[model samples]
Target: MRSWLLKSLYVLAALRYPRIRPDLRYFVRDNYFARLNQLRFWRADFLTKTPYKVVEFYGEFDQEIRYAMPFAYWHFLNGTLKQTVASKNTRPFYFFSPDHVEKYEKRVWEAGYGNYSIPNMTHAPTYDFSKWARVPFKSHYQNDVFVYDKPLLVIANKYNIEWDKPPINFLDIPALDRLISGLKSRYQIVYNRPLGGQIVHDNSEIMDLGEHAWLRTTHPEVLLMNDLFDQHAATVQNFNHLQLLVYANCNHFISMHGGTAALASCFGGTNILLSHPGGGFEHEFNEYNNLFPNLSGATILHAKSREEVFTLVEGRF
Candidate 1:
């Protein structure tokens, strides 16, 4: 009868539309709530150093101060948009205070490079000087501030962040061993991690990764990577800043910037780009609109993917 028909429809609907899983619901809710905690922690950290209302309108202070270009660039430029764009492998031009610019140029000479490249494209912040200028170490020259002494090199283990891929720890002993084996020169490298706290001492100086103790190697001292996320659990928002800080402290930084040659320019340090032929830079996430200076003195030769990383070092040294 009518009741039976209604029941049949109801059963069919129930069968077709299953209830959301409790675990998934919890995961979503947990992340939502966790984000709030994360925001509170980030705000507290900034407030401790700066005024409370500095980031009041942004809700989360960290996100407002540290931005991802394209979407955030407008906000960063205070709603001013620039028309500059990269055309088929052009280098980016950047301007610092005259004093900082002199120091910046000198570092480039010491690093023995002209232009640095980082991956980039349409949506990225068209300019990210603020993000580039702030070094984690107290010593980095900001704007007009300049430090010319021998600096420490800070490297972030961002290579393992491929979406849908496994999270590989650079501090993992076996992996470091393999990575070291591929290297010829002894470049001092400190691997930075996200610990969700203030970055303290370098972890590579202490961690005992047997056989992977490439740190023992005098020339290329390899440091262990620490999880900055775990340490700063509330404040550190992204790993890119960690890399920027490292670059600020170190004599020079070598990175693929997730394979974006354009990001290297805005980052304000020496960079080596790994170019992939015919890949058309298609895989790169260029939302940051990082400007690449087209000047020859500003850029180095691009390395095709066919070239091994070790080989590049051999020639550089």
Candidate 2:
């Protein structure tokens, strides 16, 4: 009944606000139905028979890292009761699509929750991280097994929707070059470009979804970083596991404000998060600072100027 009402509201919104019709449609199709399914599951007591409590996290990339992963971690630390998480990326949610479920399922398995995880549930779980906002996240997972021999520095550059916004967290080619040049000598720099032009829902046509052709034209240095550093570059396609492994093992991480950075916070390494001042630094800073807490080596900084970013990166090294 509520779902039907929300669906009606979505139709009304589409009719009333044609300019944002696509965005509204997405909310109705993905967000609403996913939550409705979750409500139905809870009311039906579907997981009552299971030994471990199940948390169905059906959100996009940012939500998974920022909310879902932490929500699960908090529960793991606070209680002895075993718990599993169903981290779905199916329709209505665009971050982790069905095509990429295998990698995420492998991630869940590698994290020692193989028995507990249901990474690809078709019905999908609802997004309900607000309940765990006040709850603290501790670094209970260790990366000793995954650490590299040399000091590792991980960099995650985002050039997607942020490109349209004011230059806050987005780093241009020259800036990236300077940073990479300075750090390459001391630490093994691993670059991660997790998203690409392909849309998660449909893999056929290339869209201006992520770091489109702009990165190649403007920031060729990002592509050249691997050759310069004698290391293989990591992207969404082949390096999901290695990306997480490097994050877990890295000594320091430099990342743009997004899902990738949020995931890095889970590893409890020194993280320098660059945020755009005009892009809501105060909100991002407060949310991350609170979510990860003091113990977590996560620092959110305003990237108003390139000099500040350079200084922060240099200081970390």
Best by TM-score: 2
TM per candidate comes to 0.36, 0.53
Give candidate 2's error at residue 184 in angstroms.
Answer: 0.9
Candidate 2 has a TM-score of 0.53
C-alpha local distance difference test of each model: 0.32, 0.47
Q: How accurate is candidate 2 locally (lDDT)?
A: 0.47
Q: Which tens-of-lDDT digit does each residue in 48-87 have in candidate 2?
A: 5223434454334554555454444444444422434343
- Global lDDT of model 1: 0.32
Model 2 pairs whose backbones collide = 30-92, 168-276
Per-model clash counts, in order, read 52, 2
The lowest-lDDT stretch of 10 consecutive residues in candidate 1 is: 99-108
